[model samples]
Target: MSCAEESGRIMVGQEAPDFEADAFVKGGFKKIKLSDYRGKWVVLCFYPGDFTFV
Candidate 1:
Protein backbone atom coordinates (compact mmCIF):
# COMPACT_ATOMS: atom_id res chain seq x y z
CA MET A 1 0.00 0.00 0.00
CA SER A 2 1.11 3.57 -0.51
CA CYS A 3 2.48 5.50 2.43
CA ALA A 4 -0.54 7.76 2.61
CA GLU A 5 -2.88 4.79 2.61
CA GLU A 6 -0.83 3.03 5.25
CA SER A 7 -0.33 6.08 7.43
CA GLY A 8 -3.61 7.86 7.07
CA ARG A 9 -2.73 11.23 5.43
CA ILE A 10 0.88 11.57 6.55
CA MET A 11 4.02 9.89 5.28
CA VAL A 12 7.57 9.56 6.47
CA GLY A 13 10.25 11.94 5.14
CA GLN A 14 7.59 14.46 4.22
CA GLU A 15 7.13 17.81 5.88
CA ALA A 16 4.22 18.05 8.28
CA PRO A 17 1.54 20.43 7.05
CA ASP A 18 1.61 23.78 8.80
CA PHE A 19 -1.02 24.41 11.45
CA GLU A 20 -1.87 27.08 14.01
CA ALA A 21 -3.61 26.40 17.31
CA ASP A 22 -3.64 27.26 20.96
CA ALA A 23 -1.25 25.20 23.09
CA PHE A 24 -0.32 25.09 26.73
CA VAL A 25 3.21 26.28 27.28
CA LYS A 26 5.00 27.17 30.46
CA GLY A 27 1.73 27.46 32.37
CA GLY A 28 0.07 29.60 29.74
CA PHE A 29 -1.88 29.12 26.52
CA LYS A 30 -0.43 30.62 23.35
CA LYS A 31 -0.73 30.31 19.64
CA ILE A 32 1.66 27.76 18.16
CA LYS A 33 2.57 26.48 14.75
CA LEU A 34 4.69 23.69 13.34
CA SER A 35 6.76 26.20 11.36
CA ASP A 36 7.50 28.13 14.53
CA TYR A 37 10.05 25.49 15.50
CA ARG A 38 11.67 25.04 12.14
CA GLY A 39 15.29 23.82 12.18
CA LYS A 40 14.88 22.59 15.74
CA TRP A 41 14.21 19.22 17.31
CA VAL A 42 10.59 18.68 18.34
CA VAL A 43 8.98 15.79 20.15
CA LEU A 44 5.25 15.48 19.67
CA CYS A 45 3.22 13.63 22.26
CA PHE A 46 -0.35 12.49 21.76
CA TYR A 47 -2.05 10.79 24.63
CA PRO A 48 -5.38 10.45 26.34
CA GLY A 49 -4.15 12.28 29.39
CA ASP A 50 -1.11 13.25 31.44
CA PHE A 51 0.92 10.67 33.47
CA THR A 52 0.00 7.83 31.18
CA PHE A 53 2.84 5.51 30.18
CA VAL A 54 3.38 4.79 26.53
Candidate 2:
Protein backbone atom coordinates (compact mmCIF):
# COMPACT_ATOMS: atom_id res chain seq x y z
CA MET A 1 0.00 0.00 0.00
CA SER A 2 1.16 3.52 -0.73
CA CYS A 3 1.69 6.11 1.97
CA ALA A 4 -1.80 7.49 1.44
CA GLU A 5 -3.42 4.05 1.68
CA GLU A 6 -1.38 3.03 4.69
CA SER A 7 -2.14 6.07 6.86
CA GLY A 8 -4.73 8.06 4.95
CA ARG A 9 -2.40 10.98 5.14
CA ILE A 10 0.48 12.56 3.27
CA MET A 11 3.90 11.44 4.43
CA VAL A 12 6.60 13.81 5.51
CA GLY A 13 8.20 15.77 2.65
CA GLN A 14 5.24 14.94 0.45
CA GLU A 15 3.69 17.72 -1.54
CA ALA A 16 0.21 18.89 -0.71
CA PRO A 17 -2.42 19.34 -3.40
CA ASP A 18 -3.70 22.83 -4.02
CA PHE A 19 -6.74 23.73 -1.98
CA GLU A 20 -8.83 26.76 -1.12
CA ALA A 21 -10.48 27.67 2.17
CA ASP A 22 -11.73 30.55 4.19
CA ALA A 23 -8.99 32.00 6.37
CA PHE A 24 -8.86 34.64 9.05
CA VAL A 25 -6.30 37.34 8.50
CA LYS A 26 -5.74 40.82 9.77
CA GLY A 27 -8.89 40.66 11.91
CA GLY A 28 -11.02 39.62 8.94
CA PHE A 29 -12.02 36.49 7.06
CA LYS A 30 -10.89 35.93 3.50
CA LYS A 31 -10.75 33.18 0.93
CA ILE A 32 -7.25 31.92 0.32
CA LYS A 33 -5.68 29.29 -1.88
CA LEU A 34 -2.66 27.11 -1.16
CA SER A 35 -1.15 28.02 -4.52
CA ASP A 36 -1.15 31.67 -3.58
CA TYR A 37 1.77 31.04 -1.22
CA ARG A 38 3.69 28.81 -3.59
CA GLY A 39 7.48 29.01 -3.20
CA LYS A 40 6.98 30.37 0.33
CA TRP A 41 6.67 28.54 3.62
CA VAL A 42 3.24 27.97 5.08
CA VAL A 43 1.95 26.34 8.24
CA LEU A 44 -1.37 24.56 8.74
CA CYS A 45 -3.07 24.06 12.08
CA PHE A 46 -5.90 21.66 12.86
CA TYR A 47 -8.04 21.21 15.93
CA PRO A 48 -10.48 18.53 16.98
CA GLY A 49 -14.10 19.69 16.79
CA ASP A 50 -14.83 18.36 20.24
CA PHE A 51 -12.16 20.53 21.76
CA THR A 52 -13.27 23.77 20.20
CA PHE A 53 -16.36 25.88 20.66
CA VAL A 54 -18.01 27.43 17.63
Candidate 3:
Protein backbone atom coordinates (compact mmCIF):
# COMPACT_ATOMS: atom_id res chain seq x y z
CA MET A 1 0.00 0.00 0.00
CA SER A 2 1.11 3.59 -0.52
CA CYS A 3 2.33 5.53 2.52
CA ALA A 4 -0.81 7.68 2.63
CA GLU A 5 -3.03 4.60 2.39
CA GLU A 6 -1.23 3.07 5.32
CA SER A 7 -1.05 6.22 7.44
CA GLY A 8 -4.56 7.54 6.63
CA ARG A 9 -3.20 11.08 6.52
CA ILE A 10 0.32 12.37 5.99
CA MET A 11 2.99 10.15 4.47
CA VAL A 12 6.71 9.89 4.02
CA GLY A 13 8.15 12.51 1.63
CA GLN A 14 4.90 14.50 1.89
CA GLU A 15 4.95 18.15 2.89
CA ALA A 16 3.22 19.15 6.08
CA PRO A 17 0.22 21.45 5.84
CA ASP A 18 1.16 25.08 6.50
CA PHE A 19 0.45 26.71 9.82
CA GLU A 20 1.53 29.71 11.86
CA ALA A 21 1.62 30.29 15.60
CA ASP A 22 3.11 32.45 18.28
CA ALA A 23 5.90 30.83 20.26
CA PHE A 24 7.76 31.75 23.41
CA VAL A 25 11.48 31.70 22.65
CA LYS A 26 14.60 33.40 23.96
CA GLY A 27 12.47 35.17 26.60
CA GLY A 28 10.13 36.63 23.99
CA PHE A 29 7.18 35.73 21.81
CA LYS A 30 7.59 35.36 18.07
CA LYS A 31 5.51 34.23 15.15
CA ILE A 32 6.75 31.03 13.57
CA LYS A 33 5.79 28.69 10.77
CA LEU A 34 6.53 25.06 9.91
CA SER A 35 7.74 26.05 6.46
CA ASP A 36 10.38 28.28 8.05
CA TYR A 37 12.49 25.24 8.92
CA ARG A 38 12.53 23.53 5.59
CA GLY A 39 15.67 21.40 5.01
CA LYS A 40 16.51 21.51 8.71
CA TRP A 41 16.32 18.95 11.51
CA VAL A 42 13.55 19.85 13.95
CA VAL A 43 12.69 18.29 17.27
CA LEU A 44 9.17 18.89 18.62
CA CYS A 45 8.63 18.33 22.33
CA PHE A 46 5.28 18.52 24.14
CA TYR A 47 5.05 18.63 27.89
CA PRO A 48 3.08 20.07 30.77
CA GLY A 49 4.00 23.45 32.12
CA ASP A 50 6.46 23.73 34.99
CA PHE A 51 5.35 23.26 38.65
CA THR A 52 2.77 20.71 37.62
CA PHE A 53 3.00 17.00 38.21
CA VAL A 54 3.27 14.91 35.09
lDDT of each: 0.70, 0.70, 0.67
Q: Which stretches of candidate 3 lie above 4 Å from their native place?
A: 1-8, 47-54
**Where in model 2 is the C-alpha error above 4 Å?**
1-9, 49-54
For residues 1-54, what per-residue lDDT tens digits would candidate 3 score against the true structure? 112223346667976655677788999988877668988977665578978775
lDDT of 3 at 35: 68
Residue 44 of model 3 has an lDDT of: 65
- Maximum-TM-score candidate: 1
Greater-TM-score candidate between 1 and 3? 1
lDDT of 3 at 3: 21
| Model 2: per-residue Cα lDDT over 5-52, one tens digit each | 233467788877667777679999988877789889988777776558
Q: What is candidate 2's local distance difference test score?
A: 0.70
Q: For model 3, what is the alpha-carbon lDDT of residue 54?
A: 57
TM-score for each model: 0.63, 0.59, 0.56
Model 3 C-alpha RMSD to native: 8.0
- The candidate 1 region of ten consecutive residues with least summed lDDT is 1-10
Q: How many residue pairs of model 1 clash at the backbone?
A: 0
After superposing candidate 1 on the true structure, give the runs of residues whose Cα lies further than 4 Å from its correct spot: 1-8, 50-54
